[model samples]
Target: MVWKIYMHMTSMLCLGVAAFFFGGLSLVSMSTGKCSLIEWELSSLNSLTVVFVLIFDWISMLFLSFVLLISSSVLYYSGSYMKGDKNFNRFMYLVLLFVFSMGMVILSPNLISILLGWDGLGLVSYALVIFYQNEKSANAGMLTVLSNRVGDVAILLSIGLMMSLGSWNFIFYLQDMVDEKWLLVKFLVMVSAMTKSAQIPFSAWLPAAMAAPTPVSALVHSSTLVTAGVYLMIRFSSALEGSKIQSMLLIISCLTMFMAGLGANFEYDLKKIIALSTLSQLGVMLSILSLGYPDLSFMHLLSHALFKALLFMCAGVVIHSVKGYQDIRYMGCLVEFMPLTVAYMTLSNLSLCGFPFLAGFYSKDTILEVAFMSMINFMSLILYIMATGLTVMYTMRLIFYSLSGNCNLTTLSNIADEDKIMSDSMSLLGLGAVFMGSVLSWLLFPECYMICMSMFMKNMVLMISFLGALIGYMLNMLSVSSKLSSLLYYKEVVMFGSMWFMPFLSTKNISEAYLVWGATNEVLNDKGWFEHLGSQGLYYTFSKIFMILSSLQMNSIKVFMKTFVVMLVVILLFFS
Candidate 1:
């Protein structure tokens, strides 16, 4: 245990140092407007070459810095979170593996190398998700891994497609890859990104993955695994510009944003709520990137990672204090007990809601304004507005249920912010949640984005956000005597609450049909027709024939001699 403690401290210290080094390099790269790419030729074949490539740009460097920073914090937090677990050391190793895989994806521009990291992420995340070794964890792990496998296959197909180009370094061929002939490559890449990021049909795994440990959630859902998709799209945004695929992605992301936000408002599970929020934010990043603003997308991705990680960590404290009770309905007035945890949670939540001057506000607000200013269709604009409001509404609902109101847990419950390790870990990301947005915005965008909107349009964001908050607070502030309206519209509420039954659609709905089909096939084919007409039937026929032969053999001696004598007499008569 002491050795494990020393290892944890050592890993955290190393990550912090690496973060600072990369952070400085990122700033220098930004100021100098230069990037370094180092390549090593591994082998060569006819019209094909395999090489390892490392890309060091401000974008990649800064993203790596944040990944390491958050990873270090999460690892420190996990020391306390998983201390009593038997596999604490194994957990640490898996977390480190997860981070290393993400680094590979971040630093490598080559598709083949990226796939190596990508597959590593999928495998390691499955291990992490099932760390608890329970049925729920096992099921969630299976779902998460299988959903990710689709993207893996997509990446594999894209690699096969890239072979025609003779080089896997997509960074150098963005322009050439954008032609109509290369549409399939672009489509494959988009699908791979979507699966990793959990967009639309792929969104079910994000929530299901909350069955993992909270620290893993903070790391996986925030900066590393989920964001890989958005980051991939960011790298490919140049090729996607002015293409039909980009427009299609715009619609898909917006729907994902709205769906996740609305579902979160109805969600009661604490970690799953945060997961849904992550989904919504991913939509914001991809949507903006789909609009031909990769830099803006990257900015949001970074800022969101900071606050979202903080939010998840804060949630870990709350859940840990309550003895792993995650239902928000039973949580209330937590601020009275866990003041520091609640404060940090509120900070992250408000940042998610786009409260002014915070880390989320800088990037999220910019994305909204840029969207309105873009030439998107009216329906897409409506989705943007609706999704934005839903984000605030769900955030407010979370705060109302968990931070204020009356405490519903037992009087004997011990809830306090006394865990120093947990508090210390959260403090780092709390600061990031508060200020990283403005810092990233300024650093990434030296020149200001021009905003030309009417007075009404300019105020629309604040107005919708205010309205959403008001409704969220008012609707949830029901007295004990008041009737629940959700009961009146139970079906509709369930449909909306269940992420439009996507989990069902992804799991039970699809599995149930296939299971029924399998059962039918088993009974009708394997057990019934195949048994009667196949091996079983043949066995019976062969047995009957053997039975006849055995019966004939019983009389065989006399009957055989008589038959032979008759045949010889006939032959003699014919000769005569």
Candidate 2:
């Protein structure tokens, strides 16, 4: 019956609408401070008390609005994109599940609720990633789920640690914890946030996540899942107000920014490049949030959602038109065939690159200025500079590769314009990217900027970063024999060598050798030690051991059965 109901369009639409209304009402009630209609108070649960205030923040309301809007857009777009697919009903169900889960995540008032939402989103995303049921998709889904689980465990630890410190409520605990204890909590939170946000070591999973459909990628990268990390940071920024955690966060953010930027430079896949660029921009926002400017972070988050969605959607259009080729290296001279798409893509990329007057410029400039003003340590300054430089490098590379590079005539011949639905969606998102900055001007700059200088002086560090990007772009375009071309081919090698190999080398030989042996044995031995441990089959061995020790219990069962049979026979004989 449930499956039958889900198969119908009307039913799916109703479910989506219901979820939207419920989420909206939750936000509205929180804003108005009314008793929630969906309330389920758990006074017995001490941890519930810690996160209660999370339900009522104005920022949460704003996040809910975006969640509903983007989710609705994806649903609308999917209706057409997925019209005749065999698994249309299944796809719709997953979409509904995704939206519902994100709604819960955004509206969750406590840690337990947040974890529930987080797990739900992660599960739905994994399912969606493997929707096609292909080998590559399945592998991608597994990687995504594993990485998310790692982050989820870290979050659980952070919550547990906070609770152990005698403060479970975020507001109370954050407000009441001693400086030292709070710092420790902040560290745990940062680790969790890093994994969720795909910073540095965890960043590789995001590119792999591009295995999902374009719409899923847009939803994940642009609006919801990735932003959860930033949301966490913003929600707890007050607690992290005056700690070294902020400085450490800034450094992590910068490293992610630099690595993603450099990685994107060598990427040829249009979608993968966009994914890396998303990571890079997210790093910028995290850095700003680290500087204790939630407003700036919020502004960038909004602008990034608009423009990055537009950019990804445009890439989707190109891929759809070309029958699934996403390599920008082979795609060229699309301006003639896809003039409107080119226009939209160009505008969105401009916003991404922080060109003047676009949404990105205002938000990014604000962050740069804040970082400059709030420099508490040398690490912060270095991080700020590196972040700025990387931002410029990758954003420009995305623009050049997609819109300006030399066209491969053969690839161009095979390509055509996308469907009207795809084009229209991209155009709409592009327009949003163009206009969102001016819509929220107050959040962009502090009043001090207006008073201190007659003209807004963009940070010199940012300027230098921009110059570095321009130079990199020029070098890429003008080099007759490409030095960077080889570097691009081996970019993954660099990333793996730096992020994985170096760390592996730093570990003690025993640990490193164990890892090496496990990798080899995992394939060589179908039932390897690590595999057995991973499966928790140690319990099975213990069960066998228990069976041997408790052989008397087995005899007891036989005796009891025999005694019951004898008693039944005696009763029968007496009756006879």
Which candidate has the top score in TM-score? 1
Estimate every model's Cα lDDT from 0 to 1: 0.92, 0.70
Model 2: residues with Cα > 4 Å off, grouped in runs: 1-39, 42-54, 164-167, 409-418, 443-462, 479-576
Cα misplacement distance, residue 507 of candidate 2 (Å) = 16
| Ten contiguous residues with the weakest lDDT in model 1 | 478-487
- Residues 383-472 of candidate 1: C-alpha lDDT, one tens digit per residue: 999998899888888988889976787666789988998999999899999888888877888899899988888889999999999988
Cα RMSD, model 2 = 8.2
Work out the TM-score per prediction. Answer: 0.89, 0.78
Model 1's alpha-carbon lDDT is 0.92
Model 2, 279-383: lDDT tens digits are 888898888888788878887887788888777777777776666678876666677778887888888777877778888888877677667666447766675
